[model samples]
Target chain A: DTAVSQTPKYLVTQMGNDKSIKCEQNLGHDTMYWYKQDSKKFLKIMFSYNNKELIINETVPNRFSPKSPDKAHLNLHINSLELGDSAVYFCASSWTGATNEKLFFGSGTQLSVL
Target chain B: GESVGLHLPTLSVQEGDNSIINCAYSNSASDYFIWYKQESGKGPQFIIDIRSNMDKRQGQRVTVLLNKTVKHLSLQIAATQPGDSAVYFCAETYHLIYNQGGKLIFGQGTELSVKP
Candidate 1:
């Protein structure tokens, strides 16, 4: 069984398009996170939710929002996508609050904004 | 703001050789560090991690070394294999709210080409 899974393995859209990526984890984790890997392969945290509570919100624009319907699911919505938004977005989950807890990653959603 | 990234962008090593990937972090407050490996089309996978209190941590075939004075970290791979060819990223976590102030800042990443 896949521990973490994300929808739309690949997405190709033009600028100004609004889209959403869904993520789910069966690891029964309380913490979930979103990360983006750019062309430079620089992975940055976009947002994180712990048990449905918005925890870490990076300087990402307001156009991008994350919604967690429940602790098992966290979805990302991007409005007015821009060229710079092209990259692979990853969803991750951890078991506990320990700093050493490794995040189990999803296969990732490759969003390419034309 | 983004963390200052890597100085070396790519590295290649012969199979069975040891590989060392280096990173420099600007934040002195960062206490927790992790090494992540990302293959061509997959998410970054955790390799090993070390805390500020400990200078070194070793896993099955990977080792992470941290230097507080220089704010530097390195990931050493033992007996590199073709399967090990991927992009290696160094990430750090800092102190703050249990989860709010916490963020994993990733390096630009170094491409590891394990030649067979």
Candidate 2:
């Protein structure tokens, strides 16, 4: 069974369009995260939720919002996507809020804004 | 602001040879470090990790070395195979007393290519 899974493996939308990506984890982790990988392959943490509570929010713009209904699911919604939003979005989960713990990551959703 | 960065963008190695990827972190307070391998169309996979308390840790065919004095980390892979070709990233764990969970700061990835 896939420990972590995210939907819409590939997404292509026009500029100014809005989109959402869904993520789920069956590892029974307490913390979930969203990371963005740019074309340069630089992975940056955008947001993190611990047991459905917002714990970490980076310098991301307000256009991107992350919602966690529970500890098992975290979803990302982008408003008015722009060209700069083209990148791979990854979902990850960990056992606890500690950074030292191992993170299980989903395959990723490739978002391309035309 | 502190961040993690790689010294080389790409490294080419022959199959069955050893490969080394280097990373430099500016945060001296970082106590935990991890190396992740990412293949095409996939998320980063945990390879190995080390803490500030230890200088070196070994995994299956993989080794992670940490130098606290210089704030440098390296991942060494022995007998690299063709399947090992992928982008490898080094990340440092940053803790904030105000925040509930610590965050992971990732470095610019290093692409490792194994020539058959």
Candidate 3:
């Protein structure tokens, strides 16, 4: 089974449109996270949820919100997306929210806002 | 905010040759460091990791070296293959006091090209 999976492998939407990316993990992990990778290939952490609780919230704008229905699933929702929002979004999970733990990442969702 | 960065943006090596990717981090308090390999249309994959107390750790054909004194990290690949052609990133995180999770900061990443 794929350890971590995210839907909409490719997303092309209008600049002002709203979209949501779904993520699920079958690794039985307690923590899940959302990351954004820009065109320069720079990866930045957007949000993290531990046991369905918000744990980490970076400097991301309020337009981007993360929802965790459970420990095994985390979803990202963007309202009024902009051209700068075009990038690859990744979902990851770890056994625990430990610094030394290795993260299992989903293939990724490529978002293109035109 | 402190960040991790790579010295080279791209590195090219012949097949069967050894390749080394270097990274520099500014967070001196970082106790855990990891290396990740990301290929086309894929998320980053964990390659190897090293703790502050250890200077070197090896796994399969990859080895990770950590130098806390200089705040440097390096990944050494024994044999360069086409399969190994991907972007490599070094990430570091320190323990948050009284917290279980710490934020992992990734470097700019160095793209390794294995020339056939």
Best by lDDT: 2
Going through the candidates in order, their DockQ values are 0.61, 0.69, 0.63
Clashing pairs in 1: none
Q: Give the B-chain TM-score of model 3.
A: 0.90
True contacts kept of 1: 0.67
Q: Candidate 3, DockQ to 2 decimals? A: 0.63
TM-score of the B chain in each candidate versus the native B chain: 0.90, 0.91, 0.90
The global Cα lDDT (0 to 1) of model 1 is 0.88
Q: C-alpha displacement of B97 in model 3, angstroms?
A: 3.5
lDDT of 3 by residue, A1-114 (tens): 889999999999999999999999998999999999988888999998999999899899999999999999999999999999999999999998888888888999999999
lDDT of 2 by residue, A31-103 (tens): 9999998887888999999999999999999999999998999999999999999999999999987978878
Q: Sorted by lDDT, highest first, which candidate order results?
A: 2, 3, 1
Clashing pairs in 2: none
Give the docking tier of candidate 1: medium
Model 3: colliding residue pairs: none
**Number of colliding residue pairs in each model:** 0, 0, 0
For model 2, the superposed segments whose C-alpha errors exceed 4 Å read B1-8
True contacts kept of each: 0.67, 0.86, 0.71
